[model samples]
Target: MTTIKASCPSCGDVELTPHQVRLVVCSVKSWSYYAFICTTCHEEVRKPAGRDVVALLISGGVVAEPWNVPAEVLEEHEGPTLNYDDVLDFALWLEQADLLAAAAAAQGPRPRAQAPETAA
Candidate 1:
Protein backbone atom coordinates (compact mmCIF):
# COMPACT_ATOMS: atom_id res chain seq x y z
CA MET A 1 0.00 0.00 0.00
CA THR A 2 3.05 2.26 -0.41
CA THR A 3 2.60 5.33 -2.59
CA ILE A 4 5.65 6.09 -4.75
CA LYS A 5 6.00 9.59 -6.19
CA ALA A 6 7.33 9.95 -9.73
CA SER A 7 7.42 12.67 -12.35
CA CYS A 8 6.03 12.67 -15.88
CA PRO A 9 7.57 14.78 -18.67
CA SER A 10 4.21 16.31 -19.49
CA CYS A 11 2.64 16.06 -16.07
CA GLY A 12 4.82 17.32 -13.23
CA ASP A 13 4.23 14.77 -10.47
CA VAL A 14 2.30 11.52 -10.06
CA GLU A 15 1.96 8.78 -7.51
CA LEU A 16 2.51 5.04 -8.02
CA THR A 17 2.32 1.85 -6.01
CA PRO A 18 5.24 -0.53 -5.56
CA HIS A 19 3.60 -2.97 -8.00
CA GLN A 20 3.37 -0.21 -10.62
CA VAL A 21 7.15 0.23 -10.73
CA ARG A 22 9.76 -2.04 -12.25
CA LEU A 23 13.36 -2.08 -11.03
CA VAL A 24 16.07 -3.83 -12.96
CA VAL A 25 19.53 -4.32 -11.40
CA CYS A 26 22.03 -5.10 -14.13
CA SER A 27 25.44 -6.80 -13.78
CA VAL A 28 26.84 -3.61 -15.22
CA LYS A 29 25.98 -1.09 -12.52
CA SER A 30 25.58 1.84 -14.89
CA TRP A 31 22.98 -0.05 -16.90
CA SER A 32 20.65 -0.60 -13.93
CA TYR A 33 17.34 1.19 -14.37
CA TYR A 34 13.74 1.59 -13.24
CA ALA A 35 10.65 2.05 -15.35
CA PHE A 36 7.02 2.92 -14.79
CA ILE A 37 4.04 4.27 -16.65
CA CYS A 38 3.09 7.84 -15.91
CA THR A 39 -0.24 7.83 -14.10
CA THR A 40 -1.20 11.15 -15.67
CA CYS A 41 0.15 10.98 -19.23
CA HIS A 42 0.01 7.16 -19.44
CA GLU A 43 3.48 7.18 -21.08
CA GLU A 44 6.22 4.86 -19.94
CA VAL A 45 9.14 6.57 -18.22
CA ARG A 46 12.49 4.86 -17.76
CA LYS A 47 15.39 6.24 -15.73
CA PRO A 48 18.83 5.03 -14.71
CA ALA A 49 18.92 3.73 -11.17
CA GLY A 50 22.12 4.15 -9.18
CA ARG A 51 22.96 2.23 -5.99
CA ASP A 52 21.16 4.69 -3.75
CA VAL A 53 18.04 4.80 -5.92
CA VAL A 54 18.02 1.02 -6.16
CA ALA A 55 18.22 0.63 -2.41
CA LEU A 56 15.52 3.21 -1.87
CA LEU A 57 13.13 1.57 -4.31
CA ILE A 58 13.70 -1.83 -2.76
CA SER A 59 13.08 -0.47 0.70
CA GLY A 60 9.89 1.03 -0.65
CA GLY A 61 8.60 -2.50 -1.47
CA VAL A 62 9.59 -2.62 -5.13
CA VAL A 63 11.10 -5.96 -6.21
CA ALA A 64 14.43 -5.78 -7.97
CA GLU A 65 14.93 -7.82 -11.15
CA PRO A 66 18.44 -9.15 -11.82
CA TRP A 67 19.98 -8.71 -15.26
CA ASN A 68 23.15 -10.68 -16.07
CA VAL A 69 24.97 -9.38 -19.14
CA PRO A 70 27.62 -11.49 -20.87
CA ALA A 71 31.23 -10.40 -20.34
CA GLU A 72 32.02 -10.83 -24.04
CA VAL A 73 29.36 -8.21 -24.84
CA LEU A 74 31.24 -5.70 -22.70
CA GLU A 75 34.65 -6.39 -24.24
CA GLU A 76 36.25 -3.56 -26.22
CA HIS A 77 37.52 -4.25 -29.75
CA GLU A 78 39.80 -2.20 -32.01
CA GLY A 79 39.16 -2.80 -35.71
CA PRO A 80 37.42 -1.48 -38.76
CA THR A 81 33.64 -1.76 -38.48
CA LEU A 82 32.06 -4.33 -40.79
CA ASN A 83 29.72 -3.01 -43.44
CA TYR A 84 26.96 -4.64 -45.48
CA ASP A 85 29.40 -5.60 -48.29
CA ASP A 86 31.73 -7.36 -45.86
CA VAL A 87 28.83 -9.42 -44.47
CA LEU A 88 27.60 -10.23 -47.99
CA ASP A 89 31.09 -11.47 -49.00
CA PHE A 90 31.31 -13.73 -45.93
CA ALA A 91 27.80 -15.09 -46.59
CA LEU A 92 28.68 -15.87 -50.22
CA TRP A 93 31.90 -17.64 -49.17
CA LEU A 94 30.06 -19.66 -46.54
CA GLU A 95 27.52 -20.86 -49.11
CA GLN A 96 30.35 -22.49 -51.14
CA ALA A 97 32.59 -23.56 -48.19
CA ASP A 98 32.59 -27.16 -46.91
CA LEU A 99 31.60 -26.63 -43.30
CA LEU A 100 31.72 -30.32 -42.35
CA ALA A 101 35.23 -30.64 -43.83
CA ALA A 102 36.31 -27.48 -42.10
CA ALA A 103 35.05 -28.79 -38.75
CA ALA A 104 36.87 -32.12 -39.30
CA ALA A 105 40.07 -30.31 -40.21
CA ALA A 106 39.82 -28.14 -37.11
CA GLN A 107 39.91 -31.26 -34.92
CA GLY A 108 43.50 -32.10 -36.03
CA PRO A 109 46.57 -30.48 -37.42
CA ARG A 110 46.53 -30.24 -41.23
CA PRO A 111 49.61 -29.87 -43.44
CA ARG A 112 50.13 -26.28 -44.64
CA ALA A 113 49.70 -25.84 -48.40
CA GLN A 114 53.00 -25.10 -50.18
CA ALA A 115 53.15 -21.93 -52.24
CA PRO A 116 53.70 -22.45 -55.99
CA GLU A 117 57.24 -21.63 -57.28
CA THR A 118 57.49 -18.18 -58.88
CA ALA A 119 59.92 -17.14 -61.63
CA ALA A 120 62.68 -14.66 -60.53
Candidate 2:
Protein backbone atom coordinates (compact mmCIF):
# COMPACT_ATOMS: atom_id res chain seq x y z
CA MET A 1 0.00 0.00 0.00
CA THR A 2 1.16 3.52 -0.76
CA THR A 3 1.82 5.89 2.13
CA ILE A 4 1.35 9.65 2.10
CA LYS A 5 2.07 12.23 4.79
CA ALA A 6 0.40 15.61 5.00
CA SER A 7 -0.96 18.15 7.40
CA CYS A 8 -4.56 18.29 8.56
CA PRO A 9 -5.76 21.45 6.87
CA SER A 10 -8.19 21.96 9.71
CA CYS A 11 -5.85 21.34 12.62
CA GLY A 12 -2.57 22.37 11.02
CA ASP A 13 -1.16 19.10 12.30
CA VAL A 14 1.27 17.22 10.09
CA GLU A 15 -0.09 13.72 10.49
CA LEU A 16 -2.94 13.00 8.13
CA THR A 17 -3.07 9.31 7.18
CA PRO A 18 -3.23 8.08 3.63
CA HIS A 19 -6.70 6.72 4.16
CA GLN A 20 -7.80 10.00 5.64
CA VAL A 21 -6.83 11.93 2.53
CA ARG A 22 -8.54 11.84 -0.83
CA LEU A 23 -6.87 13.01 -4.06
CA VAL A 24 -9.77 14.55 -5.89
CA VAL A 25 -7.58 17.60 -6.09
CA CYS A 26 -8.14 20.70 -8.15
CA SER A 27 -5.67 20.74 -10.99
CA VAL A 28 -5.69 24.41 -11.88
CA LYS A 29 -6.09 25.81 -8.39
CA SER A 30 -2.90 27.26 -6.89
CA TRP A 31 -3.95 26.53 -3.32
CA SER A 32 -2.89 23.41 -1.48
CA TYR A 33 -4.69 20.35 -2.75
CA TYR A 34 -4.73 16.70 -1.55
CA ALA A 35 -8.03 16.42 0.25
CA PHE A 36 -8.25 14.72 3.61
CA ILE A 37 -10.73 13.74 6.30
CA CYS A 38 -9.39 14.02 9.83
CA THR A 39 -9.47 10.68 11.64
CA THR A 40 -9.41 12.18 15.11
CA CYS A 41 -11.78 15.02 14.27
CA HIS A 42 -13.34 14.01 10.93
CA GLU A 43 -12.84 17.48 9.57
CA GLU A 44 -12.93 17.60 5.84
CA VAL A 45 -9.57 19.08 4.79
CA ARG A 46 -11.05 20.11 1.50
CA LYS A 47 -14.16 21.61 0.04
CA PRO A 48 -17.11 19.73 1.55
CA ALA A 49 -19.88 22.00 0.37
CA GLY A 50 -22.47 23.91 2.49
CA ARG A 51 -20.92 25.60 5.55
CA ASP A 52 -17.39 26.96 5.79
CA VAL A 53 -14.38 24.74 6.51
CA VAL A 54 -13.51 26.58 9.71
CA ALA A 55 -17.06 26.29 10.98
CA LEU A 56 -17.20 22.62 10.19
CA LEU A 57 -13.79 22.05 11.75
CA ILE A 58 -14.75 23.94 14.86
CA SER A 59 -17.94 21.96 15.20
CA GLY A 60 -16.08 18.72 14.61
CA GLY A 61 -13.24 19.67 16.99
CA VAL A 62 -10.63 19.51 14.27
CA VAL A 63 -9.01 22.80 15.05
CA ALA A 64 -8.81 25.15 18.01
CA GLU A 65 -9.20 28.34 16.05
CA PRO A 66 -12.52 28.94 14.36
CA TRP A 67 -11.64 32.36 13.02
CA ASN A 68 -7.89 32.21 12.57
CA VAL A 69 -7.75 30.69 9.11
CA PRO A 70 -8.40 32.72 6.00
CA ALA A 71 -12.00 33.23 5.01
CA GLU A 72 -11.55 31.30 1.79
CA VAL A 73 -9.87 28.42 3.60
CA LEU A 74 -12.64 28.43 6.15
CA GLU A 75 -15.16 28.29 3.36
CA GLU A 76 -14.05 24.82 2.25
CA HIS A 77 -14.38 21.87 4.63
CA GLU A 78 -18.13 21.92 5.04
CA GLY A 79 -20.22 18.86 5.73
CA PRO A 80 -22.01 17.08 8.54
CA THR A 81 -20.17 17.40 11.82
CA LEU A 82 -18.68 14.14 13.07
CA ASN A 83 -15.39 12.75 14.27
CA TYR A 84 -13.92 9.68 12.59
CA ASP A 85 -14.75 7.34 15.42
CA ASP A 86 -18.20 8.80 15.76
CA VAL A 87 -18.81 8.27 12.10
CA LEU A 88 -17.61 4.67 12.27
CA ASP A 89 -19.55 3.87 15.40
CA PHE A 90 -22.70 5.41 14.04
CA ALA A 91 -22.29 3.53 10.80
CA LEU A 92 -21.84 0.23 12.62
CA TRP A 93 -24.86 0.86 14.81
CA LEU A 94 -26.97 1.77 11.81
CA GLU A 95 -25.81 -1.32 9.95
CA GLN A 96 -26.67 -3.56 12.89
CA ALA A 97 -30.07 -1.95 13.29
CA ASP A 98 -30.78 -2.37 9.61
CA LEU A 99 -29.75 -6.01 9.74
CA LEU A 100 -32.02 -6.66 12.69
CA ALA A 101 -34.90 -4.92 10.99
CA ALA A 102 -34.34 -6.85 7.81
CA ALA A 103 -34.22 -10.15 9.69
CA ALA A 104 -37.39 -9.32 11.57
CA ALA A 105 -39.13 -8.35 8.35
CA ALA A 106 -38.02 -11.57 6.66
CA GLN A 107 -39.42 -13.57 9.54
CA GLY A 108 -42.77 -11.89 8.87
CA PRO A 109 -45.76 -11.80 11.24
CA ARG A 110 -45.96 -14.42 13.94
CA PRO A 111 -48.23 -17.31 13.05
CA ARG A 112 -50.88 -18.62 15.45
CA ALA A 113 -50.38 -22.21 16.61
CA GLN A 114 -52.68 -24.67 14.84
CA ALA A 115 -54.89 -26.85 16.96
CA PRO A 116 -54.02 -30.54 16.92
CA GLU A 117 -56.48 -32.79 15.01
CA THR A 118 -58.84 -34.68 17.39
CA ALA A 119 -58.89 -38.45 17.05
CA ALA A 120 -62.18 -39.55 15.34
lDDT tens digits, residue span 1-120, model 1: 889998877888889999999999999999999999998888999999999999999999999999999999999999999999999999988876878667888899868999999999
Q: Whole-model Cα lDDT per candidate?
A: 0.93, 0.54
Q: Give the TM-score of each candidate.
A: 0.75, 0.27
| True-structure lDDT of candidate 1 | 0.93
Estimate the Cα RMSD of every predicted model relative to the unseen true structure. Answer: 8.2, 17.2
Worst window of 10 by summed lDDT in candidate 2: 24-33
Report lDDT (Cα) of residue 43, candidate 1. Answer: 92
Clashing pairs in 2: 53-74
Tell me the spans in candidate 1 whose CA falls farther than 4 Å from its real position: 98-120
Q: Give model 1's TM-score versus the native structure.
A: 0.75
